[model samples]
Target: MDEPRGDYWYNLVTGKVEVGAQSDWTQLIGPYASREEAEHAIEKVHERNRSWEQGEED
Candidate 1:
């Protein structure tokens, strides 16, 4: 059987990584696969936005 992957969230209001859905939906960024990914959620979003503005596709 495959191991279960945990859900991680990035709190937009507090700018912190959470283990799960512990905050209000409006303030959380996502269900990232890992803590490290959750920590960089904002950075990833900004990067993607910039790419879109430059006519680039990921």
Candidate 2:
């Protein structure tokens, strides 16, 4: 059997995952092993973006 690859979450803006190889920042999103994990990460990105936007309004 093939070894299972672990899931990873990539930042949309920074293009860096919590765990993974470095790559072109702009082109990085995810190599997640499952869709749920990817969705979770995306939620985080959205939360951060919202916070930043709010901060900018201040």
Candidate 3:
């Protein structure tokens, strides 16, 4: 069974890692599976964008 837990979020404005929503939805990045992953959310997004631009995801 799935258990409920507080999700992680990256606040774009303050560049903070939150255990749950503390800011407006438009200013956050995620509900990442883990805190560590959420902490690197921006880097992850940038990496994915780079891969896509280079067709590395193909």
lDDT value for model 3: 0.84
Residue pair clashes in candidate 1 = none
lDDT for 37 in candidate 2 is 71
Mind sharing the TM-score for model 3? 0.75
- Superposed on all Cα atoms, model 1 deviates from the true structure by an RMSD in Å of 4.8
| Leading candidate by TM-score | 1
Model 2 lDDT tens row, 1-58: 6424564657676644545535664655777775457547777778999999999999
Candidates 1 and 3, the one with greater lDDT: 1
Model 2 misplaced regions, further than 4 Å: 1-7, 10-27, 30-39
lDDT of 2 at 41: 73
lDDT of 3 by residue, 1-58 (tens): 6423549899999988888888999999998777787889999989999988889646
Measured against the true structure, the TM-scores of the candidates, in listed sequence, are 0.80, 0.42, 0.75
Colliding pairs, model 2 = none
Candidate 3 or 1, higher TM-score: 1
- Model 1, 3-52: lDDT tens digits are 23568899999999888789999999989988888889999999999989
